[model samples]
Every structure is written in C-alpha cells, then in structure tokens.
Target: MLTNEYLKRVYEGLEKRNANEPEFLQAVREVLESIQPVVEKHPEYEKAGLIERMVEPERIITFRVPWVDDQGKVQVNRGYRVQFNSAIGPYKGGLRFHPSVNQGILKFLGFEQIFKNSLTTLPMGGGKGGSDFDPHGKSDMEVMRFCQSFMTELYRHIGQFVDCPAGDIGVGGREVGYMFGQYKRLTNSFQGGMLTGKGLTFGGSLARTEATGYGLCYFTAEALKCMRNDSFEGKTVVISGSGNVAIYACEKATQLGAKVVTMSDSNGYVYDPNGIDLAYVKDLKEVRRGRIKEYAETHKDATYVADCSKVWTVPCDIALPCATQNEINKESAEALVKGGCTVVCEGANMPSTPEAIEVYLSNGILYGPAKASNAGGVATSGLEMSQNSERLSWSFEEVDAKLKGIMEGIFHASYDASVAAGSEGNLMVGANCAGFLKVAAAMMAQGITY
Candidate 1:
C-alpha cells in the first residue's frame, strides 16, 4: 500500500489538473491500487517519474464534425482522439462511435489500451478516439456523412506507420468503409494498412470479427486448465450481449463443446435450455439486426426476459460478460455466484465494477479481466496490419491458430505475473502491473519527451 503522505500528494496533484475526468480517474485508481507494491519495490521507477507520466496522455485532439442529414438538415457532433502513449511504437487502437462516448471514457479506454496493447508482445502503442454520435436508427447516408466528417479531422493525425484505428462498439464494417473512403479521397492513396477491420474486398482479414470471442474462449480455456485441470467440454456457459463479441464468444464456446444457454442484449435476454444455436444467433444479430427477443420467438423452449439486468439470475457453470462496463455490479455478481458460476471472463471493458471483482475474488471464483482476456481482437488487427505490409493475407484457419496462440500466451503471461507478484490467482493486479512495467520501461529507455 502507498504511504498516506504519498497518496495525499498524488491526490493533490491530480486535483489541480484541468482534465479531472471521473472515468479516467477510476481507471487510474484501479491500476495504481494494484501496483502499489510494485511502486514500492521499484524505487527506480518512482525516481524516473514513471507513474506520473503514465497517468497523463501524450496528446488529445478534439474537433467538431459537421454533417448533413437526409432531410437537408445539418447535424454536428464532437470528436476526440486520445494518443495515450507511443513508447513501444505508433499509436494503435479502436475508434468507438456511440451516444455515450466522451473524452473521459475515451481517456480511460486509451489509458487501459497502453497496457493491454503492450501485453500482446506487438509493436503498438496505446490510443483511442470516438464521437458522441449515435449510429443506431441512422440511415446509411447519415452514417456515411458522419464518418466522412470524422475522418476529415482524423486523417491528418493517422497513417500506416504512425497511428492505426479499428472498429469498436458502434463502429462496424459500414463505418470503416465510410471512413476509409473519405481518407482515400483526401489523401489520394489506397494506404490500406492505415486502418484495420475493413471489408474483405479492401483488405480486412478473415475471422477478424471472431477473434475477440474466440480469443476469450482460448484464454478461458487456459485459465480453466491451470486452475482446475479441465477444459470447456460439456460445461454450461452463459454469455451476455448480442454484439460482435458476444455472438463470437457463443460460437467459440459452442465449438469448444460447451453448452451456451443464454445470450442477452440491452433490451433483454433469451434463455435456451437446449443450448443456444450459433447459426440462429448469427442470423438474429448479424443478418437481421433484431433484438434478442426474436430468439425466444423462434425457439419455443427459450425464455425471454425484457429486462436485461435480471438475466444473471439464470444458472450456469461459467459466465461471460461481453457487455458494457460496470454492467455487473455487486448484486449481479452475487446472483451469478448463487447460480453456481465458477468462472467469469470479461469480454467487455471493465464489465465488473471493483465491488463485483472483490466479490469474485473473495468467493474464490476464477475471474478474467477485459484487458487481458479481450485482447484477441486487437492482436488480430495487428496481424492484419502485418498482412497488409506484406501484401498477403493468411487463411482463416491460420489466422485463427495464431489468435489462439496469442490468447494462450497472454493467459500464461498474466498467470505467471500474478504468481510472481505474490498475488497468486489475482489476475487483475498481475495483468496491470505486467503491462505497466513494460510500457514504463520502454518510456524510461526512450527518456522524457513532450
């Protein structure tokens, strides 16, 4: 633990900053709390002012994006790009598009990405950007307009060897296409490697959408093997969210011989006693873009709950929260524990609050944090960048194999770090410290720079 005097000084310095973002503060607090021991052990890092630099971003770009709607009405939205670090390499992260996006959330995500990207053993730094634009219910023209406007400001700050952005929560293939198109028109160059998660025709790799979910399962498989000497075969699993990550997780879990029983979206959840069919889930979420309630309509044995928060009450051996941050609080964690869940893997960023994590740790349940577990998507994106650079693409099977290897390697890295840090089995702290130490070392070697 940090000395009371040291913490007080740190808190005072934090209070004086103009950017007192709550989400960013929360993320920093989590990381700092976990790494206090490391701070004490490594006096050289403290002397080098590593933690101080780690708390702040290198650059933040904010701009207004103006677009025209279908009705000839002009719309405007705020945009942001937080280049959190570049100690390892150029900035590399996702560009989110959602109504809830803001500087605070983006900063927190970017800060986390610094460590997460480092853990992948790839030459990529941390960055994140997004806008307060809601893509849902928007026409293709509106989305295209917004993407073009966004890329106009963004293109100036990004490139193939500099910064590469990919899709996140609200940004999908359509959004990537729009942004890439605008970038091409302005730069007058293809430069396909400047972005990832593109359409297959343009340069996107196969199984990129499935990377995160399949990677989640692969990491969880490693954890299970280490903890219980077992695998996913015949184990019952429950996953939340109907997005790309959730659907892919369901697919991977089913392929690994687990019976996934329930999947949910913001509206509600569908509990299928006969195990969720991956084909039906893909059709509903990907093809139809319908609510999870549609699942219950087709599968008579499944029960649909309109309120998603209540879905945790269903029983399962493993729980995969692939939804938003802080979705599973103490109450939800308790419900999951009561339902016989022995493992909880997060596919979403910070899905479990600190309270919920405490509950899991105290109960001796195996918990996988998002930074360490959900890295497969970005890892595969890095692979896509490699392919683009080489002017070649690997087959789906080859890419999937590489993704599995990376996930497994990350799991073992986190596990070993946890054990060595004397917080054996406490993966959250271990992962944060492992990732932070690497970035901090790189920063120190490079020396201080603006």
Candidate 2:
C-alpha cells in the first residue's frame, strides 16, 4: 500500500515473516508510512537497506519462569526480552509484567523504543522485556519468587552497559526492587546502574516516577503554544488509565491550571466534571490498590461509567490516552473530534489505533505520537544512569527541570522536522521523521554491522 517502492518491498517482507504479530506489524507500518518521503529524498537509505534491517530485531531471548504460588503449587510463565536495535548504545527499555506479555507485544514496544530513545537524544538503544506472570493478587513472596526465577535467566543477557531494563505495565518500583535484588545476589555486584526505577535510597533518580507524566504535559504545552498559540491554562482535559502515568499526568496537568476530568482502570472509568482528585487517585492506585469505581462513590458529584472505552466520549479541549495499546478505536477518535477536542497526546505506547490516528490527522487535531511525547520516562532513566555511573545524585527540582528542557527540545525537533518535510504542525509525521532521520543516519554510518 506504500507509494515508495523500496519501503513497500521491505514492509511486505516483514508482513510475511511476522504474520501473527499484528501489534508489531501495525507499529512498523506506521513508521514505514511516515518515513517514505525521507526515504525517497535520500537514496542512501535504500542502498544501505536501512528500513529492512531496522524492521528486524537484533536479538530475542525467551525462557521459562517457574515459581510457587501461595497454594503451594508450582506455576510456569513465559519471559521475553527483545533487543530491537543497539545502533546508538546499549539496549534500554522496560520490563512489563502482565498477562498480556508476549513476543509480539514486546517486539512492538521495542520497535517503538528505537525511535523513542533516538528522539530523546540520549545514548541508549532500544529494547524491551517482560513476562506473562500477573502481579495482581499475588503475595509478595510469590511475586518475589517469580522475579527471582525470571531474573535467573535474564541476568545473563543484561547489564549496566549492555541492556538496562526499567518498569512498565504491572512492573514498577516493587517488581524492579525484587529483580534488582536477585541480580545482585547472583552476580555479587552492586551495579546499581544495571537497572532503573529503583528505590531512591539505592541510586534511583528523584522524579523518575513523575518524569513520564510531567514530560507528556510539557510536550503538549509546547506543541499547543507553538502550533495554536494556546496553553493548558483553563483547558478541560480527559485522561484515561489510573496507573502511574495517568495519575502523575493528572497531577501535573492540574498544576499547570488544566482540569483533568476523567481516569479509568481496566474495569471502567470515572468522570469528575470538577476535576480529578489526584491525591485520592494516588492513594487508591499506588497504596490501597483499589478499583477506579470507588472514585465516584467517594465523590458524589462524579459519575462512573462501566465502559472503559467510553473515556474518549467525554467532551474536552484535550485528550490524553495513557492506557494500553489501541485503547482508542476509530469510533472513539471520531467522538473526540465531534466533542471539540483540539489536541491528543499519548501517554502510553501506541495508545491509538492506526485508524484512530487517521481520524486525528484528517480532523487536524494536534496529535503527539507516543515515541516523542512519552520519551520522558526513558530520558529520566538515562539521567539515572548518569547518576549511577558518576556516583552522584540530583535533587528532584534538578531532575524535573532537565526533564522539562528535554521535552521542549523534543517538541521543537518534531516541529522542525514536520516543517522541513512540508507537513507543518503534523506531529505524528514530525516525530516519526525526526526520530527516523537520526537513526537512519546512525544506521547508514554504522554500515550493516548489526
């Protein structure tokens, strides 16, 4: 379906080889479509087979993770680590612990990470790892045992300078703590830099948890100011998901004078017309680990909707989808446009389906792709890596300021790339072109050595 012959051939080969990996296919097709103009402009990319090679991962590791549950029964799970590209530096990504963890999903995440990491202007490459073990409803010991077993094999494949993994999905500070402890036990090395999202007392960077959420707003604010001469002040924002990203985004948006009206979990969504109470959300998700429906029960003015997909239906000036991949479908996207939503920024990996993206572009919505908008988390991890390597620590304000600066730079990079490609203000293509331009150059210069 691509107009460029070289890009089309490369994509077709990938589609044939990865027939079952729809998520990976969807991610690759999006990037391929965006970079076609760049490919035609620079024949060296085709000569170097950059697109073809970039579509394939450098390495994939899978293994069995066996552990004991509270019932005194042994359970088995699958673990995967996809090192998609290391053309820039060591493989760097997150470790997701969810029932949905699979090779295809990790490939999609890792593939996106290549561009995401490049957009940060950091030295880290792209990688992702996770397991099919659900951390929910599991005892601490059970989770610890699974972490140890998963790390028993994963430890050999990762390191401080090789591949450093962070947290995603069900994996967070608790899961990371367990895995880092196991790695230390096995290697007898206190290599704090080997992993990120660590507890603050142990080389973890301050503001890492808030980085992704705050960074998303920073990027959105920059995009709005530059593209529409507007800001987040007095904006009605609708956000999805009740996890760390969503919770922190609610906090930062409120700080910037925007009223975030909605948040959801897998069960459903809660809509608060007066603005979300982030303190309650943080305690509910981060502490009590309760469902989002409780929000309506606590606040009489708010209403709870049983359908999680209906989050986008709430009318607002801006929409931030911080949930899982494809959470917003074509219909949901149309609803946003109809509701007068002028901007859409992703806080999750591939939160919008390709069809949904089409709606955004056609409607002239200010769309910010996940790779560029959500790069704050990984960028802060890079700062953590620097701190660990240098045996130094930075204050929360210092890290937050750096994160803000990096996000502003990312916005300009994408905007400049968009203008250069004759598609000004289209951040979807802007992010892709900006990200691809850097990696494409790196790949061509490095030759086909990967």
Candidate 3:
C-alpha cells in the first residue's frame, strides 16, 4: 500500500466535506482503497492532486418538487442533481426515483458512475439525480405530476451537451417518458439525447432495457470461462430482485442453459428447486408488476420465504444480487458461502456491504462488482447517445452484440489491471484501478481548475 499519509489526507478532506454522509464516505473509501496501488505507481496523478478533485462534484443542485397526490392533496419532496465529473465528456448516469433517494446516495452513485462510464471506454462523464418520492403504487397521473415538477428544476441543469440522466430503480419507461415530456415542454426543443432509457417510441435504444442484465450475464459468463473453469450450462443460479437487472439476468442465464433456482424481491424470495422459467418471472414482474411471492403460490415445488433476508440461504452455483444498496450483509455472505456459491455478481450499486465483500473475497469466490458487472446499462446508454447524435437507431442484434463486446472488454481490462497490480485475480482492485486511472488521467490532462 502507498503511504497512509496520502490516503489519510484525501480521506480526511472527504470526511470534512461530507461530514455525515455515510454513503459518500463508503463509496469514496472503497474506490480509494482499491486504487491505492495505482497512486503509488503513478506519482504524476498524485502531483496532479487527482484524488482531491475526484470526490468533489463539479455541480450539485437541490430543489423542492411539489406535486399533487391522487387525492388532490399537495405533496412535496426533495430532489437532487449531482454532476460529479465531466473530464471525459457530458455527465451521464441514472435518475433513481425511490423513496431512499438522497444527496449522499446520489453523490455516491454519481462518483461511482464516473469510473463505470470510464471503464466502458465511452465518451461520457458521470452524474446522478433523483427525488425521494416513491413511484410505486402511484397512479400514472400522480407520477406525471411529480415528474413534471421534478423536471421543472432538473431540466435547467441538464442537456444533450451537458448532463444526461437515465432510469434507475423506480424510474422506468413511464417515469422517463414523463420526465422527457416535461424537459421538452420546458426547453421547447426535442432533445432526444438529453436522457437515456427512454421508451422505444421516443428514440430509446433497442436492448437498452436489457443491457445491464444481459451485460452482467455476459461478464459473468466470461469470468466463469476464464477464471473458474466453469460454464453456465446445467448450473443452478440464485438471483435477487425482479427488477430490470435481475429479470434480464435470469432470462439470459436461462438461455445460457442455467437453471435459475431462486429469485427475490424487496418483500421476499421464491425458490423453485426445479429451475425458474424466465417467462414466468417476466410475467410476474414486467406484466403484473407483482412480487416474487406470487410465483410460489402457483408453482407446486416453489417455496416462498416472507423474510427477504433469507434469500441468500438458497443453494446455488452462482448468486446475483440485483436489488438495492447494502442488501447483502455479512450474514448473507456467510449464507451464500455455506450454500456453496462459487461465483457472485452484483447487479445493483454496492449491493454487498464491506463485510459481505470481505467474506466473499476471503473465501476466494469469483466476485464481480456492480460498477464493472452492471455497466451494460450505461454502456448501452452511451450507444443510445451516439445513435441520437446520428439520428439512427441500431437493431437489437447490433446493440446486443456491441454490449457483449463492451462487457468482454471491461472484464479483460479489469483482469489486466489485477495482473498488473500483482493482485492476480482481485477484480475489485482491478475494476477500481482501471476505472480510476482512466478518469484520473483525463482529469490530469484537463489541468487544475478551481
């Protein structure tokens, strides 16, 4: 490790700036810890003070989103936009619309996006924005009202050449459409590239919906082939969450001849020992927008566990967490290990806590971090940006092929970084260093700016 002195200085500065922001602190610490070797190897980056500026976002905007509820009652919520970096190109990331959205989470997400986007080799920086309002169980009109109010302020900070936001948890096609409509109305311009993950009718890219999940499976398959001497064929996989990432991951896994045994939601998990069929899971989630427990009711052999935390207990060769942040803790990690999980991949941002990560790493499980594994979404988003710029949309096969190439490239990059760092197969360090060095070099080339 490099001098603790430099790490201490950078960490202390971040702590002082974000005194009570645990998410920001956690995100920064993880990236910094992984990139410490890089700092030691590259004195010029240190001379450039790259670490100091990397954590400080270039722009942050907070505003009130006032809308009307279904009952015609006025509702108010806080919204935030954190433009973390722009050294590469325009700011790019997702707009999460969950109740848990906050400045700390957005900052953490945006900061992570910088490296994730960089790892994609795409011309995009990083930014994340969202509101704390929950979109679930809300009527379409209610969501539209909230989206309009949120975009009223957000549109000012975003543009095709500026920051671009896509959909995250709770911000699906419906939310993106509403947000895009509002942006167009406010700006009086048909700025198609201003946001990604748009519906197909309004210039959304083909395969954008399945990019992250499909990309994750692609990366995991590549890792299995290269590192584990294993294949997805005839393997039992357990996946958490039924959202975009989880659902598509399940689909691709099934297509690869893997039987997905278990899938979960925020409520609980459903384990079908006879391998989960993708069509069933998709209908439950995409069509009905219902919970996983519903699957247990219909499938004879499937068992539903109401306690969501126990989802990790199901035995499988592979485990993928596609849920929210910090969903997997040390206990869940132990459960996964005990259940004989050989590989684990993240489909969500920081789904596994530090302790959980330690357990997996110590056990020598092939683990893929969210930034590297789940980068397919943003990579395709970048493709969408290019298509918008060219006013041409690629076919699904073309986009999927490109996405596969990107994921493969990312895995090789991370693997090379690991080998270069003498960490061998430590993908965490590989991903962090690979991403950081790219962005840090870009920042260095930009020179110092106050």
Candidate 4:
C-alpha cells in the first residue's frame, strides 16, 4: 500500500535492478515503506529523487586478498568496501570478516548504516566493508597475515575524514589491531582516527567493547519506560548470540535488575533458568572461543538446545536478537508473544524478518529497530573518533555517560518522529522516518552530484 507514486516508482526500480539481492531489497523496501508518511509530507524529496539516489551506493570496492597461511600456502579471499553514502560526513561502519560476507550483505548493512549513523546525530554517513574470510579456528599468525593482506588494499580507500571502519562479527580487537598496524605501516603515519575498536594501547576508547550491548539495554529501558511506564527492573530477559553485544547486554541488564536467562551462539543456545553467569559465559566465548553448549555442560541448572532460534520459546519479558540478520522469523515472534514478551529491541542489524516485525507491531509489543537501538556502538565510535582527533582518551566513565546520553537522544528522536508521523508508538516507522529525514535532508542539501 504505497500511496506515494514517487516512493512506489523508486521501490519498483530498486526491485528491478536489485532483484538478486534479497537482503538489500528487503532493507530498501523496509525503509521505503516506513518513510511513505514522510514522503507524503515532503514532496520535495520526491522531486529531488532522494530515495533513488540514497538506495544506490556511492562506490563499491571489490578486490582480492591473497595471504600465506600457517602451512605456507597461498590463499585468496575476496574483499569489499561499499561506500554507500557520504552526504553527511565520512563513511563509517564496521568491517565484518565472516564467511557470510557478500556484496548483498554488505550492501544491506551499509544501507542500514547510512540511516543508523544518521540517527546517532553524528556526522558519519553509511558504508560497510568486509571479506568472505572466516576467522574461526585460524591461528593468530594466520589471522594477522590475512588482516594485513586485507588492509593492504583497504588502506587506500579509508582515512580519518574519508572512511573509518570498525569491528563487526568475526572482526574484533585482534583483527582491528592487525589491520590498523598494517594500515599504519602502509601509510607510514599513525592516523588513529582511521579506525575505531582498536586495542587500548592504541587510540581506542574505553567502554568500546561493552558499548553496543550496554547501549541496547539503555535504549530498550528507555523504550519501556517511555511507552509502557516500565523498566528493566525485575524483568526476565533473553538475548541471542554470546558475542560482545549479547554478553554485554546481559551484563547491563543484570546490573539494571533484570535477569537474563538465555544466550546463544551459531550452533545452539543455552537456557539457564537461574540466570546466566556473565563471567563464565565471557570466559567460554571470549577466551576459550567455545560453543555455547559448554555453558549447559558446566551449569547443571541449564539446558542446551541445538537450534539457536528455539531460544525464543524459553520465554522472557524482553527479547534482544543480537545475532545475525533474520535470526527471528514469524514463528519465533509468535513464540515470544505467546511467552509474554512485550519489548523487542534489535542489537543486530535487521535481526527480525518482516513477518516477525509485523507480529511485534500487531501484538502491541514495543519494537525498537536496529538502526536506532543499535546505533550506540557507532555513536561511541563517533566518540572514539573525537578522542582520536583530540589526542586524548577519555576514561570509561566519561565515554559510557556520553553513550547513555546518545542512546536516550536517539530514542526520543525516533519516538517523536513516529508520533509526528501519526504512528505514535510504531518505532519501526519512527526510526526509519527519523533516520531517513536527516540523511535525506543532507542529500537534498548537497544537490545532485553526478
């Protein structure tokens, strides 16, 4: 039901051109659908063809990364950097090193980054880059060599005021350290601002590791408080993925008086009715790099489930899908609702499918889209960028406070935009519309740049 002709035409054109990229198309469609009300209000966006321009990337860099493995064998991996937009400022996003990294996935992430970064009220525009190189089970040297090879090509495309890349999924401090070291060596200059999520010895900001997870809870707490006059206190929470986002989200929620009952990995999920031990989970996932089933083995009170998606059936007051995209579908959403879940906040990009989102919205569940709820990581990255430029590293408390303020601001912005758009509590529409307005305005201001 796209009533606006311009929005409909743009979406149709996107479908025709990007029919093969379902992830990208889905991201585009979701935003376009949410912004219909905005389009109706602002006809000038249609005249300027803002949606069409915004949907297409500014540049896409794909190259080959060849490295020597521990066995002294040459291996080649495809690398990509999609500079989706820079109308507002330099391109800022994470470099994911998962095997699932592809043009479509990166495009979807980069497209979402444009709006996500916009929602942060930071100057960063959207862009995402990564390779099909999987870091799992790789030796330290092998990972280092691969990261060096990746940066040898990536260094040329990024700069402090150009594009700043951070960590995501398979990429972490080790990968960032390796890549930054290589980038510094190639350029023969120490441009700390060129990357965030660096090691503490470098120009990395404190609380950077916990920012996303902590930020998710902050945003979710705000959503609950504002919408339902509730908080995380005394609530049961379920978080997917035992990675940085999920683990820290669990920590923050527990600190805020909520008991997180479950955490999952790619292989499976662990349901601990007694609440997860953040220390033990961290040791297993971070240090040991072990599967989540280990938690069940260690804690007799916990039960291990083979299917990760089934984590939804365990039931909770709030659900945070910090795992990969589309991890939760319609059925999962139904289970969450049936389990008495009232709030759904995305810690990962597009974690819920369209059907899942519909279930949340139709069921009166408060839904916070990834762009707004998860922008904390990037917002803190923005803070890291500021610290880098200033040659000063703020303490963890300073950075965490700033992150909390930014998340609160984003929630209010999205809430207000949703209300103004006649969808008072639909955060999906609110976040999309609010994020789009800022970037669209910037794009319109910049005029056609062909």
Candidate 5:
C-alpha cells in the first residue's frame, strides 16, 4: 500500500528491526503513509538518511523496579524509558505506571510524542517512560515505596534540560507527588523541572488537569467550524473512558453547549440521554475511583452497557474515543458512521485502528487525530515548565487562554497541511506531515549523527 518506493524500502527495514513491536510498527506505518508527499518534496531527507534515523530511538533504558508491598513481600516490575527523538528539545513525555507498560507501548507513545510536542510549537522533544507496576489497589505507603525505587534508578537518567517526565495513565497528582519527592530526596536538591503534574502545594500549574480534555473540545470546535461551519453547540456527544481525559472532555463539551450522553471505564460504559452529570462524575472517577457502571445505580434514567467497546454504538453527532489503544475497531467505526456521527476525535494515543480511521475518512467525517487533538496536555506541561524556569506561576485563566489558542493553531496546522498535500481535510495526514516537517528539518540541520 505504501506507494513510495523509497518509503517502502525504509519501512521494510524498520519492520524487520522492530518486528516484535507492533505498536511501534503501527505508529511508524501511520506516519510513513502520510509522509509520502514530504519524501517526494525533499531528496535531501533521503540523502541524509533521516527517515531511518527517525524510526530508530536514540537510546532506550530498561531497568528493574523492585519494591515491597504492604504484605512485606518483594514485587518486581519492569521499567522502560525510550528517548525516541530529541531533535527539537529535551526528551519530554509522561511516566505511565501501569501493568501494560512495555517497550513497544512506550516506543509507540514516545514516537507519537515527538510529533505531538512538535505540533505544539514547544521546545520539548519526544520521550516516554513507565513501568509494569500497577498502582491500583495499593496502599499509599506501598505506592510511595515503589515510586521511590522507580525514581532511584530513573533519577540518574533525567534532568531539567535532559529528559523531563510528567504523569500518564495510572499516574496522577498523588503518584507525581511521591515520585517528585523521591527525585528530590535522591538528588538532595530542588529540581523544579524534574517532574511535572506536581501537587498545587508545590510548583504545579492550575489548569494542567483540565487542559487535555478542554483542549480536545477546543480542537473539535475548530475542526467542526472549519469543515461544516459548525461548532460543539447543540451537538450530542458520546465519549469513551471515564478517566481524566474523558471526564474533562465531557465537561468542556457540555460547557460549549453540547450534551455528553455517554462515558465509560474498563468495566463498561453508561449512557444518559439527558446528558452526563459532571459533579457526580468528578466525584465518582476522580475522587472515589469508582466504576462507571455505578452511574446507572445513581441515575435511574441511564443505562449501563457491560461491553466497554460498545460505547461507540450509542447514537451521537460527535464521538470522542478518549480511552485506551485500538478502542474503536472497524465494527465500532461502522456503528458510529451508521448512527450518523459527523466528527470523530481521539483523546488517547492510537485509540482507533487503521480500519476505523479509514471508515471515518472515507465517510467524510471530520476526523481529528490524537497528536493534534491531545496535544493540549503536553502544551500545558510545557507552559508549566516555563513557569517553573521563571520561578513564577500564571493564573488559571491565563494558562487556559493560552491552551485554547494553541489548540486552535494545531487544528489550522493540520487542516492547512492536508489541503496543501492534496488530501484536503484529511487531518491524520495533515497532522503527520505538519508535525514531521519541523522535526525532520531540525534533525537534518543537526547532521546525520543526530
């Protein structure tokens, strides 16, 4: 399917080297598919061997994270840090502390981070690190000990301008607080830029928590306006995942006059035709960490579907897959298209399969890729980094306003790039081409050793 002969050869080599890393391979293939126009435009890239270097990580660190639980037994977890590319800035990404953390997953995420961060026009490069240690159901003390052990090994490899990390799935304010504390304790110095998503009592930003979800809606609004001369106003939205991204996206969509009808966790999804309750959802997921199925118990009108992926089946004008990877498959995509979804925006990395994206694009749906739609989180993190460096904090309103502008910029960048590449309105291709141009230029300018 790769029509470019040069790209085909590069992808084959990349495939052979990273055959076991399906997620990474998938990420690379998606970018390659979009960059054919760029390759044809620039022979210097091929001469410089930039594509081959870009696919391969600059360095990868795998370490052992051993700690004791509340039961006084030793548990071991594998930790990974894939510094995929630093052509633009320091290796910057989140630390995901989940059971699914692996090299392939991190590489996929890190590779995506390169473009996501680049699209933000920020000075941060791409990197991702995490462990297979699930923080769920663990006592605070137990979690703290594991974070300390994880930081003990992670401290040496990261610094302010080196490779800064923030929070990701299974890692939040509490986890960040623990890890930041450990990093400080281990270094015996105040490293303000060491970790982001810190507690408010420390150097954390005000709008950091709501940035991603709010930004997703902002991007969606721009996409709607660009393609249909529309907005989130009066739209019906169905969003997957009850985590931070999903909840806040629901909140922002409702604020923009859209009715968010559904939200889900791993257990299942819940549909409330009357629109979701934000205060209740915030307490349930953010405070109590309760399952989304409990929404049905609390609200008599809502229905709880036991199948998580079936969240997409709920009828809506807009569909936001804010959940895990490959959440929206071909069947789910068909269901959304058949049900009359006009827009599909991703909040999670690689949340949609290739087939699902094809369905959205071929159906003339206004589709927003994850890199452009979900760049708000890292953009806010970058803002926090600037505030830290300046030893000052911006007001919540100031940060939120900046985030909105950046999201709008991202939308236009993708939309304009797609138009320029002869694939008018294909946001996936537009975003990939737009984000790649900046990083590719930086990499080429720095020479082949970069």
Candidate 6:
C-alpha cells in the first residue's frame, strides 16, 4: 500500500500498462512503497511527474535475433534493450543470455540498475538488454554466431559513451569476447569502453571477475560489524549458485574467516559440512563447466540435493542468495528464520520475493538488498570503463581496494538513509531511498524533458 497519493497513482498507471509484467511491477511497487517518505517530503516531484517518467523507460528496443547452429539450423530468438533512465549518466547494465529473457525481466533489471548505479556514486544510468537464447549446451561456434547476430542490431543503439552492455547470467567472458569482437568488427575500431567483463588481454579490469562475490562479503561484513558488532569470522555461510558470483563469494568468505557450507546450481545444491572446497568448485563449474552434482560425487563427505531451493534449509549464520531473481520465496524465508540465520544479503538482482523480504525484516534479520550489495560488479565495471577510456589498467590490489571502499560506502549510505527515514535498520528501505534520492535529485536538477 503506497501512502502517497501521487506514488499510488503512478503505480496504478504502471500496473494498467504492464499488466502482464509481474517482475517489473514488483520491482516498481517495492521502490515506490519505500520512497513515500521522500514523496511526502518533496511534493514538487509529483507536480513534475517525476515518478511517472521514471517508471517508464526512455526507449525499448525489441528485435528478432536470427542465428544458425553448428548443424546449419536457423534459430530465432527475441532480444530486448530497455534504456530506462540516463539522467545521471550513460545507460549502463549487463546483457543476459538466458531462456527467460523477456521485456518484463529486462525492464525490472533496468529499473533496478538506475539506483544500483546511483549507489555506486558513479556517473552511470540504468539499461538492460538480453536475448532468450540460452548459451548452455551450445557449441562455441553456435554461441559465437548468436553473439554476432545479437550485436548486429544492438551496435546501432550502443556506444562507448552511450549504452554499455556487459555480461549477466548465461553471458560470461566467452560470450562477452564474442560480442566485443563483433562490435569491433562492425564499427571497424577498438573501442574498449563499449563493454566490460572482457578477457584481461582485452579491456577487462583487474578484480572485475571477483568484484560481485567479494563485494557481497565486504558489504555483509560491514553490516554485521555495524549492527551486531560482529563480522564474518566463524560464521557458517550458505551461498546459492555455482557461477562466478557464488564461487568468488565462497572464496572471499573463506578468506574472511567464514566457512561456506553449500553452493548450488539450477539443477541442485551440494552441501559439505566441512566447508566447500573453493578450488574444486571453481575447477568443476568454471573450467570444466560441469554441474554441481559432480562435487558430491568426487567428495564422499558431501551430499547433493536435487532441489536447489532446499539449500536454504541447512542451518547457517548467514545466507547469500547469489543465484537469480525470486529464488528465496516465503517458504525459504521461513526456513532461514527458523534455522537461526541472522543475515541475508542478495548477490543477485531481486533474489528475494517481497514476501521473503517481509519475513526477513519482521524477523529482525539484517537484510542487504541487491542494489547496494551487488553494486560491486557494476562498480568495477565502471572502473573498467574508466580504465578503457584512459587506455590504462590497474593492478588487482588497486581495483580490489577501490571495490572494498565502494562497498563500505554503500553500506554506510544505506544505513544512514534507513536511520534518517526512521526505519532504523531496514536496509531494503534505506537502499531504495538512498539510491532513488540520488537519481531523483539529478532528474529534478535537469528539469522536465518532453
């Protein structure tokens, strides 16, 4: 229930227009509900129709992506790029390549990026693009062809100083390399700033690969220290996902004196009470591209469960949902609360459902929202963009130090915003308000645009 009249009207309008877009609606409602305080404080925003304009994207590009497989079979996939807002800076976000890619999901992600970028204290706006073409089980050649086709139309809408797309979900370094190569060939120039998450030999920044996961831990450590006078030391952490974020999160958690007991993929989750072996998980998931079940098979002490959601059932001090959107539902939230989980930080965008978040908040858990906690990846991406613009690369330690400082700053901002809003320790509200205030101020300063 949005208390502000203008905010409620804007949300109702969004619902009418995006009736079928539950994800986008959820994202919109969450932010709108959180920002009622700001709306009440600044009635000028309503008179200027800022909420209406901000909820709607500036441009939505949809096109048919036709590519051929290794067997010469032509396949068609739908691609989309939603340039949500650029009031603060250029449109910057990741290009996902999952089968679930749709206008609704992209819009939700783009909307979230607006604030996520704002939280980074960087001059980057919100945009997200992706195709429904799944890269899993595809041959290298097939993936390359798809990337080429996807970039063919996308190149016209993006540039170094304009929209910059990086990797998300199924899109990784291999896919980024393919897309970067296509963009370079299409434009006939080496504009490295056009993409992040590229190979080190290309324009990718140091610590970019580990930024999100490592940053999750850093943010969590700050929250723990501030709220509970504690840290990750001796905490039993359970992380969801076997991808880059989870793997590196596990590595960083281990380094920070925490034991990561579980890591999961879509198919299932593996549990090792003695703390997961980061080396083997990385080798299996990153290098071999194998499923997480292999970890249980190789290590007799571990057990593999077919249901990935059950990973939350294990008792732990902290939980990091690093997998995907809405992964932690109400039932999972209940499980975490019942199991004595004190903190839940999102390493993936909108990983917890509204119900799940409500449960966590009511239970007095220190919840770190994705926009602030997961901003590390894009923060480092911003760093990559700076490096590319200067044609200079910083060392791993340099980038890592910067990433750490940014994550800490995000925590404090969210914390202070929460306190100022009278919500005390509610990070979701704090993050939404903090992130939105920055972009909203910039929008107001720039004046109205028809």
Better of 2 and 5 by lDDT: 2
Quote the lDDT for 60 in model 5: 97
* lDDT digits (tens) for residues 1-450 of candidate 5: 589988999999988988899988888999999989988999988888889899888999999999999889999999889998999999999999888888999999999999999999999999999999998788889999999999999999999999989998998998999889988988888777768888777899989999899999999998888789998889999999988899899999999999999999888999999999989999998888889999899999999989998888888999989988889999999999988898999999889999999899889888999999999999999999999999999999999999999999999999899988889989999999999999999998898782
* TM accuracy, model 1: 0.97
Model 6, residue 175: distance off in Å is 0.5
Using lDDT as the measure, which candidate wins?
A: 6
lDDT of 4 by residue, 1-450 (tens): 576789888889888888889999889889988899888888888778788899999999999999999999999999999999999899999999998899999999999999999999989999999999999999999999999999999999999999999999999999999999999999999999999999989999999999999999999999898889999999999999999999999999999999999999988999998999899999998999999999988899999999998999987999999999999999999999999999999999999999999999899999999999999899999999999999999999999999999999899999999999899988888999889888888889889999
Tens-digit lDDT string for candidate 6 (190-249): 999889999999989999999999999999999999999999999999999999899899
Predicted structure 2: clash tally: 0
For residue 133, give model 1's deviation from the true position in Å.
0.8
**In model 3, which range of ten residues has the least summed lDDT?**
1-10
What are the TM-scores, per candidate, against the unseen true structure? 0.97, 0.99, 0.98, 0.99, 0.99, 0.99
Segments in model 1 whose C-alpha atoms lie over 4 Å from true places: 1-8, 15-20
The per-prediction tally of clashing pairs is 0, 0, 0, 0, 0, 0
lDDT of 3 by residue, 20-127 (tens): 789888888988888887788777766777788898999999999999998989999999999999999899999998888889999999999999999999999999
Global local distance difference test of model 5: 0.92
Clashing pairs in 6: none
lDDT of 2 by residue, 335-387 (tens): 99999999999999999999999999999999999999999999999999999
In model 4, the worst 10-residue window by lDDT is 1-10
Question: What lDDT does each candidate get?
Answer: 0.88, 0.93, 0.91, 0.93, 0.92, 0.94
- The TM-score between candidate 3 and the true structure equals 0.98
- Write model 1 residue lDDT over 299-343, tens digit each, in one string: 889999998988788999999999888889899999999999999
Model 1, residue 319: displacement in angstroms?
A: 0.8
